[model samples]
Target: MFGNTLYVEKIQHALEQSNFPATPDNLYDPVRYMLSLSGKRIRPLLVLLGADLFNIENIDDALPASLAIEYFHNFSLVHDDIMDNAPLRRGKEAVHKKWNESVAILSGDALLVKAYEQLAFVKVEYIPELLRIFSQLAIEVCEGQQYDMDFESIDSITGDQYIEMIRLKTSVLLGGALEMGAIIANATLVDRKHINNFGVNLGIAFQLQDDILDVYGDPSTFGKQIAGDIIANKKTILYILLKSKLEQEDTQEFEDLLTNKAITSDEKITRMKNLYQKYHVVQEAGELKGKYTHLAYESLQKVNVTEPQKKELYSLADNLMRRTQ
Candidate 1:
């Protein structure tokens, strides 16, 4: 079984070896800078793992597809950061923050084009399916973003709607990456579908875990601002659950906490967290995460591989679910 560590190293090396054009510094420099930030390469790792599961003869053959996913992922991040007006990424200046917004926009577009170019390197037979998955995911990502923006102006959103939003915005890419790898390995249709489901479910749980961490994770290790979601009223799962459970009388307090500009950010977080505990939303969110995590494991089990062969993926899912930061 190929371990994640080995695959991570391989992905890292391949990304390092990739060459970008030198001239037109404004355009290419941000692309280089964004890649250099190097967040967890989880999406590409899924691509390699999906291919490996089917006993693909040459892992190297999948490198282009794997890189394509990474490029697309970074491209999404660059634009998301700009849209979010996020100042930091991986503890460094975000692309739009480092350069100007216009440059960040152009560079992000370049990354998206580069992703298609990488896809062009795949075998001709695999290209059609890969493009289908990639394009569908790309469109869904945009839809998810639009929905997310729509939610900002709306007062309330249901739990199912939040789940669907995260599924499109974040989970599908992970699933698509796995499917692309399965295509490269020439996996059976059933196996491909099962593995894709596995990645998608795991992604849902992963994002819910992030929701839990945002309020509760230690600020020092959380990477981003702890309780940032709460402060922003970002409609996280926890927030949604809290809204669903909160007493009608307390809804005013909730609104006050979010709208009261006079309170310190820490005070707002503490009060909201206290309310979260009072309504048991935090525990409820954890249980929901566990439910999806279990579903992910079940999906992985349907992949037609032996139990021993699934151990590494099992371990990967376990570590991701339990991660504190």
Candidate 2:
């Protein structure tokens, strides 16, 4: 019966109390620093919400899984920043930039270890299934990351390929978090499958929303540089759709503009936005996001829980879909 705000507070308190070795400042400090950064904490919240759906009275039972998800997420961010050569994370200095790449790598590894350590505290009966799912989730995320990198080197990628990549990299973890919570509550297999599907579909929608925001969102609110995808020549859904819509000459121009170093970042962003608007790809992307959102709702509705029990998750999904950041 607790709301999202209370659940978030509980997660924050647990993170604050997490134990880390003090002497090896270089190794552990980056891990601590990365965790301290501002984030939505949506993944962990899903863990609690999943358990709450089953009417689990003592939410504390879900805390270990929540912490595990958070730790793994932050660990991914640390390494992802390094891979992207991103100087900022959560609008502050990135771990690699603040410290050094080697230290950041070590710290990120340490965080992954910490994530497993947290998983060790989950209820004994659920441990085996949780470990299996968590391990698979971890491997899939890596596959997604590798696919993303592979796309960077290629000329074109199908929308299906892109969707699959994002699913593995982003959506699976969300599903895993919720499923872990359901496992802890001893929910039936059918209910677990339904909730996990709900989360996976919702996560796809969430990432699509992110693609839109990256182009049009306010920099201050978005928590990252606007048109960063454009600058990096990322094959976002918008870019992919736009590429498909462009004629041969327009496609050539598009590629040239992206590769042109003479243009300033602002100029590149402005020009790209013009192209996106001209092709109406943003609207198309919105429609694609809506498709996944509908699928998510369908999955949630199929869950055995009563409508009243599902209200918070539905509200959270709505808010996430509408978010500007």
Please provide TM-scores, in order, for all candidate models, with all chains considered together: 0.96, 0.94
Task: State the C-alpha lDDT per candidate.
Answer: 0.89, 0.90
Ten-residue segment with the worst summed lDDT in candidate 2? 248-257
lDDT of 2 by residue, 1-325 (tens): 8999999999999999997889699998898898899788999999999999888868999999999999999999999989989898988999999999999899999999999888889888889998998899999999999999898888778777888999999999999899888888888999999999999999998899899999888888876678889998889999888887887767766877788889888888888888899999999888989999999999999989899999999999899888764
Candidate 1 least-lDDT 10 residues: 217-226
Highest lDDT model number = 2
Model 2 alpha-carbon drift over 4 Å, by segment: 218-223, 264-267
